[model samples]
Target: MLPLLLVPPALSTAFALAPVRRPFAAAAAGWVVSLPALELPVHTGIGVAAVTAGALAVGPVTTADRVGTGLAALTCGGLAVVLARHRAAARVLDRAFEGFAGSGAVDTTTRTTARNRTPWPTVLLRPWPVRPRSIRARRGLVYGPDPRANRLDLYTPRDGGRPRGVLIHIHGGHFRAGGPSRESRAMLFDHALRGWASVSTTYHLSPTPEAGFPQHLVDIKRLIYWIRTEGPRHGIGADAPIVVAGSSAGAHIAMMTALTAGDPRFQPGFEEADTSLAGAIGLYGYYGRLGAETKDISDPVRHPADGAPPVAVIHGTDDMYTPVKGSRRLERHLRAGSSNPVFYAELPGAQHGFDAVQSPRYLAVVAAIARFTEPLAG
Candidate 1:
C-alpha cells in the first residue's frame, strides 16, 4: 500500500525528468506534471505529504512494509533534488541578457527593481495564477469582424492612468486550440503592475475554413491597427511603445509581426496602417515553417526584411513540443539581419508553457523581459 501510494508522484517525477514524448497525451500530462516540477516548493510539500501519509497509513509491520517506506523516502528525497534545479534558471536568464550590453538595443546596465521571487504561498493555495485587484481586465473587445475569433482581452491599471507602454501577447496551441484567456496571466499581471497595458488577443484557428496560413497573421495586424487608432479611448497613450510577445505558435506570429511591419502583403486592406512594434519576445517558440503545405507563410526566419526590432527568444532545453534548436536558429538569423540585438535565454530543465505558473523560472524570465522592454518604454 505504501509503495502503491507513492507510485503516482514517482511517475510524475519521472515524467518531469523525462517528459512524455507522445503527441496527444504529452500535451495534457506535460502541463499537469510540469507545474509542480518547476515550482519546486509545491512539489516538495506534496512529496513530503505523500510519504508521510503512506507511512502513517501503513506502519512497518513487515519486512516488505519497511522496505516500501524506505523506497518512498528515497523517492521524496530525489524529487527534492529535482525541485532544487529550478534555481539555475536565474543564471540562464543572465547569460541570455548578456547580449544586450553594448548592442544598442537597450541599456544593459539599467535593471528593473523587481526580484525573481516565486510566490510560494500563492502557489500552494491557488492552482491557477491570480490577477491582482489593481489590474483591470477588459474582455471581449472586438478587433475584427468575427466577434468571437478576432477579439482581445486588454489588461490595464485600475487607476486608469496613461500607460507608459503596451504589450500585445498572443496565445499558442499549435495553431489549433487555445485562446487569450488564462494564458500568461503571470506575465500580464506583472507588466500591468509596471504601468503597462497588455493585450491578449485570439486568432482564427486552423481547419476553421476562414482560418489558415496568413489569416492568423492578418488578424494580429488588425488588432494592432485597432490599438493604434482606438487605444487612446481606452487610456493607452499614443506615445506608448507597443511590444509584441507570444508563446509557442503565437511566438512565431509575434516575431513575424515585428519583422514584417508595414509590409503591404501582411497588411492586406489595411496596407497603409502602421503595424510596427517597439520589440518582440518569443517564449518556447517555434520558428520554422509550419509545414511543407504552409511554406513561408508561418515562418519567422524567412521574412526578416530589415529594421527588425530588438527581439528576445526564450526556450526550455527540455521542451517536448517545440525543440530548442528552432529558437537557436532564430537567434542566429536575427543576429545576422536584425538592426537590434537578439537576446536568447536557453533555460535548462524548463518545459513548455512555463509562463503559465509564477514559478522561479518564469519570474526570472519576466524580469529579463522587463529589463529588455524598459528602455523601449522611455
Candidate 2:
C-alpha cells in the first residue's frame, strides 16, 4: 500500500524529467503535468499530503509505507529549495543581463506590485489568470483580410491617457494552434496597468495551404502596419515605440520580425511601411524551421542582421518540447553581431508554458521584461 501510494508522485516526476518524442497523447500528458510541476509550492504540498497519509494509515504500517513516507519527505524538501529559487526570479533574471551592452540595472522592488500577489485560495486551486478590470480593452478589432485570424485585442490603462508605448504579444501553439485570448493575460494586464498599450493578436496557423513560412510573418507585418495606421484613433500614437513579444512559435515570429525589419520579402504589399521594432521578448521560443516545406529563411538565427534591437530570450532548463540549448545558441549568435543587450534567462526547474500562468516564476519574468523594455520606450 505504501509503494502504491508513491506511484503518482514517482510517475509525475518521471513525466517531468523524460523527453516526449512520439505518441502525441504521451506528449500531451507531459505538457499537462509540466504545468503543475512548475507550481513548486503546490507540488510540495502534495508530497506533504502523501506523507500525512502514510502517518495515518491503519492496520500494521508496513516497512514499504515508511519508505514511501521518507521518499515523499525528500521530495518535499527538494521542492522547497526550488520554490525559494523561483521566488528570487528577479535577481536570477538580472544576472542574465550582466555584461550585455546597454543593459541597465533592474529595480526588483518597484516592479513587483499587488497584481503579482497571488491569494492563497487562487494559488491552491490553480485557476486561469483573468484580465484585470483596471485595464480598458477593445476586443476583436480587425487588422487584416481574414476576419477571424486577423483580429487583435488592444489593452490600455483605464485612466484614459494615451499610451506612449505599444507592446504586441503573439500567442504560441507550434505555429499550428493558439489564440490571443488565453495565454499571457497576466503579463498583458500587468503592462497595461503600467500605462503601456498592449495588443494581443491572432495569426494564421500553419500546415494549411494558405498559411506557412512568410505568410504567417506577413500577417504579423500587417498587424504592425495596422498599428501604425489605425492605432492613433485608439489612443496609441502613430510613432510610438513598439516592442514585440511571443511564446513558443510566436516567439520565433517575434524574433524574425525584429531581425528582418524593412525586408521587402516579408512585407510584399506594404514594402514602404516602417516596421522597425524597439526590442523583442521571446518566451520558450523555437528558433528552428517548422516543417519540411518551410525553408531556411524561416530560421531566426540564420538572419542575424546588423542593427538588431535588444532581445530577451527566456526558457526553462527542464522544457520537454523546446530545449534550452536553442536559446543558448540564439544568445551567442545575437551577442556576436548586435551591440544591444541580449538578456537570456534560463529558469531552473521550470517547464514549457510556465508563463501561461501567473506563478512566482512568471512574476519575476514580468518584472525583468519591465526592466528590459521600459527603458527603450519613450
Candidate 3:
C-alpha cells in the first residue's frame, strides 16, 4: 500500500490534475512523476505484491480504502495493456513513410525483428547510457551578445567531417529551465556517429524575461542565419540541408518555424536571409500560441500551408504533457496542407521525453529519423 501510495496512484493522481506549469521549482516533482505512469508494470507488480503481503500480515482496512485499492488494481491492468501495445511503434514508423528511401523501396523488413528486440522486458525502464564513445562536442560558442543565454553546443563524429546534413536540436523545459546541452544528447551523438553534424542550441526562456512570444522565435531565427553564414568553417556548406528537431515545448517551436519559414516578423534584421529548413521533427509537442496572433503565425497546425518541408513527428500514445491527440491533429493538418510528406509515429506506452537516452525503442526512432531525413540530404 505504501509503495502504491508513492508510485502509480500518487503519480497518476498528479497526472490527472495536470499541474506542471510556472515557477518551476515548485512543479519539479511533476517532471519525474510521469515515468512510473508509463512504465507501470514493474512498479505496479512490486506495489501489488507489497500491498498483498502487508494485507495478509495486518488484515482489513476501511471500505473507502478497499475501494481505492480496487481502482489502483484497475489502473495497473489498463497500463499493462497500453505497455504491451507500445511495441507497435516501430510498425507505425514503417507504415508512415513506406517510400522514405525511394519509390517502391522497402526499409527494415529484415531489420524489423531486430529493431524491436530487446535483451529483456524491462530494458527500457533501466538507466540509460550517459557517455557514448568517440563523440565530441564543442561547448559554449558565443553566438549572441548575452554569453550565458546565447551560447550553443555543436556535436560531431569523433573523426568529424563537413557533413551535408545537419540536425539542429532545441531543448524543452516549458520554455523555462533547460540549456542546449541537456536531454537529447544521445540522439545527437548517434547522428554524429552516422557522419552528420548535430547542434544543441539555447534561446531565451519565456514568462520571466518577457512573455513567451516573439523573443524566443527571434533568437532561434538568429541562430539559423548564423549557421547559414558561418557553418562552413566547421564544414556545413551553404547549400547543405538543415533539419530542425525538438522535444516538448521545443517541438512546438520547431514545428512552428518549419511552418512559417522566414516571416519578417520573426527575423528582424535577417528578414531577407534564407531561413528555410530541409525538414522539421517534433517530439511530443503542443502547437498552442503564447500571445495574441501578433503575426499570421499563431500555431503550426493553424498556419500550415502548401510547400512546407517534409516533417517527421514522433509522439507517445501515453503522453500526458502534450497529449497524443494534439500530435494526431498536427499530423493530419500537415498531411492535408503541406506539399511534402509528413511521417508520424506514436510509441504506445511511452511518456514524454522517452528518447532522451539510449535504448532499443529510442535507437529505432533514431533510425527512422535517418530514413526520414535521407531524402533531404544535399
Candidate 4:
C-alpha cells in the first residue's frame, strides 16, 4: 500500500523534470511486476527497488514516498555534481574565448570612437505667438524628489476663464540623449497658439549603466501623474482633458504609459479607481505585440487588461528605428479588442524625427494630430 502510494508522486516529479522525455514507460513496467509480488514483503521490496532503479536511470524523482526514495536521493546528488562540472567548464571556455578575441583592447577602441563622435546639435527657440497675453512661460520640476531629473517648461494659455485643454509633450532621445528644451519647443508654441496649455519635460539620459532600461519610463510616469494632479494650481482645470504626445522614444514611453493606465506599478492612485486617459498620440512610436519574439522589445510596464485610451499613431514608412509596421500592428490589435478609436497615418518618404522638426511633408502629420484633438478640446 505504501509503495503504491509513492508511485504517483515519483511519476509526477519525473514528468516535471523531464517533460520531453518519456520516463513513465519504465514506471509502468515496474508497476506490472510489483502487482504480482504484493503479498510478500521480500517480493515487494525487490519490486520497489526495481522501480526506483528505473526512475533514477530515467529522470529526477522526489523522495516524498517510499517507492522511489533511493532514486530521488541519487538523482539530486547527480544533478549537483553535473551542475558543478558545467560551471567549471563554462569558466574555462569564457577565459579562452576572451583571450582569443582580445575583448579588453577591442572594447577600449569602441569606447574611444563613441566618445569622439560629435554630439547631436541642440537649440532651444521660443516663438511667442500673436496672442502673447494668452500664453505664460514658467519652469517647474515634475518629480521634485530628484534634483538632477528633467525640469518641465509649462506654457499656460491665459484666456482668463480656464484652460481649454492640456498637452503634455515628451522629447525623444533614443533613450540616451536629447533634451526637451530644443526638441519640443516648436510643438509648445503650436499648442499655445491653439489656446491649449502645453508642458515640455526634460528627463535623465543614459550616461551610466544604471540609467538604461526603465528609469526614463519611471520619470515620464512621474511627470504625467504630477501634471494630472497639480495642473489646477497653474490655471489648468483638474477635469481638463489631457493629451500625451511624443516622438520616437518619447512616443514609446507615452504608449507604454497609456497601455499601463490602470496598473498600480505605473500609477498607484489609478489602481482602484478609473484612470482612463483622454487620448494618446504617438509619432513614429514603437509597439510590440505581447509574446512576440523580438530583440528590440525590452522590459515593459504591466499593461491593464481592461482597455486603453483612444490613440492616434503616425509613422513614416521609411522610419529606420521604429518602423511603420509596428504602429500598424498596434492599430490592428487595439481596434479588434476594444471600441476605442485608433487612427494610423503612414507618410511615404519621410524618415524618423521628421515630424518633430518641421518639413513640408511633416506639417500634414502635425495637422492630423491637431485635428484629432480639436473636437475633444472644444
Candidate 5:
C-alpha cells in the first residue's frame, strides 16, 4: 500500500525534474500533473493528512512495509515542498499584477464602475470545461501565390457586424510541423464571442524548399499586410485593434515581427506597407531561439528600444522544456529599455503548452489577455 501510494507522486516528482520524454509522460506532465500543482496548497495539506490517516488505519504490517511507509511519507513531504513553489509563484504574480486584470486598475480602490463589471465567459472561467463552439469561420483562404504555404483561416462572429478587434494566432511546432488548424483551440470562438475576428495562419514548415528563416516570417508578413490592406473590404480593418500572438515557436516569430515593424528583410517586396501591430502576446515563449543560446542574432530582445508595442507574456514556472528563466530575463530587458508597457504573468505550477485546453489557469490567463488587448483598440 505504501509503495502504491508513493508511485503516483514519485513519478510526478521525477517528471517535474526531468524534461518529458515519452508521449504518455508528455501528456501527463503537460496537462494532468499541473492541475493539482496549481492548487498546491489545498492538495498538499490534504495529501499529508490522508497519508497519516491511512497509515494509522492499516497497522500490524511487516518491518519492510513499515520502512516503505516511512520512505513514502518522506517523499510526500518533498512533494508538498514542490507544490509550495507553485503557491509561491502565484503569490508573486498576484503581488506583481493582481488588480490589473481586465480593469487596468492598480488596486481595487482605483477601479471604476466600468472596470468592476466583468464579462461572462470572457474574463471568467466557463462553468463547463469546453470552449464556445465556433461560428461563421472561413477556412483555407489563399493569401499568397504559394498555394500550400500561404493559406490562412478567419473565424468571424456569426452575427454580421464589424469586429471590435482581430487576433492573428500563429501556431508553434519549432517552425517545422504545426498548422493553423493544429492550435488556438480555446481562443477561436472566444475572440468571436467578444466581437473580434480570429486569424490563424500557416507558414511554410521547415525542412521544405520554401521554408527558411525570414521566409516563414514573410508568409506571416503577407498575412499581416493582407489584413491591414484588404481586411476592411471584408469588414475587418483599421477600425479595430490588431494583435499578433503565438505559442513557443510562433511566439518567437510574433515577437520578432512586432518588434521589427516591417523591417525590409522580413518583408522583401512589400517593405513600405504599414506592418505595425497594435499589441503582441506570447505564451510560454522566449526572446530568441536555439534553446537558451543567444547573441547578435535573429531574435527580438536583441533589438529592444523605446516605442515598441505593448506585450503580454505568460510563462509557467514549472516549464522545463523552454525554461521560465528566459521569459523572466526578457521581461527584465524589456522593462529596462522599452518605453511601452510590459504585462508579464508567471504561473506557479504551469508547464509548457499549458493552455491547450480550458482550465481554471487557462481561463485566468485569458482574462489577463482580454485586459491587455482591450486597450489596444482605438
Candidate 6:
C-alpha cells in the first residue's frame, strides 16, 4: 500500500505544478517500485503487490503500515511551506504587473482577471483531443429512483440499429468521490461506435467516515439487476452479451458482481435471473485479501464460493498504485477455475487510470477493446 500513499501526494503535486507531468511522474514511480528488493523477496513481493494495487486503485504512492502516515504528514507540511513561498513570489509578480500597468501599457484589472481565469498550465498543456461525431453523439442517460443514491447514465450508438452488446461501466473515486457522470466518456463512445451499448451508473458512496465494504457492492448489484431487466427496452436485448467494466473501486464492484453471478446471496427482485455475465474488465482494481490468506476481501458481498467470471485484466507495468502482479495473480486464479478466459495486458510506462480516461494510452485501450469486441459484435 506504500504505492497508494505515494500516488495521491505525487498526483496532487503534479496537478498543482504541471498536469502534463503527471503521467511521467506516475510512470516513473511505478517503475521504481517494481524492482526486486535485495532481501526477503516474499515480503517485498507482498508489500509491492499491495502498494501497487493500492496505488492503482487509490492513486499515487502507498505505504505498508502506520509509520508511513507520520512521514506523509511531514511531506504535507513541507508542501505547505513550498506553497507559501510560491505565494510570496506570486505577490512580487503581481507588483511587477502593477508597475507595468502604471506606465499606461495595459489595463491592470482586465489583465489580472485574464491571468486569474487561465487554468493551471498543466491543464492547458495537455488538452484532451476533440472527439468526432461518431463518438460524441453516442452519449445518453437512464435514471431510477434511489432516495439514497445518484441516477445512471447509459451511452449507446446514436444510429437506430439494435446494439450488438452491452458494457456496464462503473466509475472509481475510492467509492467516495466520483459518480456516474464522471464515468469515462471515451469508453462509452468507443463501445457505442463498436456496436456496444455502455451503461455507466452511480452508487452510494461512503457518506460517513465509518461506511465501507458491503454498501458499495449492494448498490452495484441493484444497478446490475436494473440493467439486466431494463436494457431490452433500451435496444440492448436480454440475450445480448453483457460485460462489466470498472476502474479502481468500480473494478472491485465489477469483480464482485461477476463472482456473485447466479449465486442466491446476490439474487433478489428479478425472477429467473441468470446473472452470468459475458465477461468482466477490471482496470487497476484492488484484489487479494485484506489480511493474510484472505483471497476474498469482500466477505458476504463477494465470497470465494461464488463462481468467478471471464475476465480481461489491463494494468500499467509501472502502476505504483495497483501493481500489475495483482492482475497476474488474478489471471492465475481464474485460469485454475473451470476454463474461464482470462486475458491480461501490461502497458509499458503506463499508470493508473490509463485505459479509461482521455490520455494517449486511453485511446490505445479503446482501440484494443474495439478489436476485442469486433468478433462478438459480428
Name the best candidate (by lDDT).
1
Total clashes for model 5: 0
lDDT score for residue 129 of model 4: 16
TM per prediction:
0.90, 0.85, 0.77, 0.58, 0.72, 0.60
- lDDT accuracy of residue 355 in candidate 5: 61
lDDT per residue for candidate 1 within 1-378, as digits (tens), equals 666766666666666676766784766676576455554545555765766565767544666566666766666666666656566777777766665667656646644333445455755666467788999989999988899899899999999889989999999988888889667887887789999998998998996322477888888998888888889999987667899999998998998899889988888889999888899999998888876766656677887647788888899988877889999898888989876777888887788788876666776777778878878884
lDDT, model 5, position 77: 66
Q: Ten-residue segment with the worst summed lDDT in candidate 3?
A: 101-110
Q: Which ranges in model 5 have alpha carbons more than 4 Å from their true place?
A: 1-94, 98-134, 208-211, 289-297
Global local distance difference test of model 6: 0.56
* Residue range 198-289, candidate 6, lDDT tens digits: 77777778853126455566566666666668877777776787788888778877887787776555455553567777778787776654
lDDT of each: 0.78, 0.77, 0.70, 0.55, 0.67, 0.56
Candidate 2 vs candidate 6, lDDT winner: 2
The true-versus-predicted C-alpha distance at residue 314 of model 2, in Å, is 0.9
Alpha-carbon runs more than 4 Å astray in model 4: 1-134, 207-213, 268-275, 289-306
Whose TM-score is greatest here? Answer: 1
* Candidate 2 accuracy as lDDT: 0.77
Predictions ranked by lDDT, top down?
1, 2, 3, 5, 6, 4
lDDT tens digits by residue: candidate 4, 248-366: 77787778766766556554444453344677888877665323342233322234323766777777554555667787776776667646666666654334565433322333344
Candidate 5 structure quality by residue, lDDT tens digits, 168-238: 89888778887885565566556777788888888888873224577777888888888887888778865
- What TM-score should be assigned to candidate 1? 0.90
Q: Rank the candidates by TM-score, best first.
A: 1, 2, 3, 5, 6, 4
| Residue 249 Cα positional deviation in candidate 2, in Å, after optimal superposition | 0.3
- Displacement of residue 351 (Cα, Å) in model 2 is 1.9
| TM-score of predicted structure 3 | 0.77
Provide the RMSD of all predictions against the true structure, rounded to 1 decimal. 2.8, 3.8, 5.3, 24.3, 6.2, 19.0
Better of 4 and 6 by TM-score: 6
The runs of at least 3 residues in candidate 2 whose Cα sits more than 4 Å from the true structure, single-residue gaps closed, are 1-6, 17-28, 43-71, 100-127, 208-211, 291-294
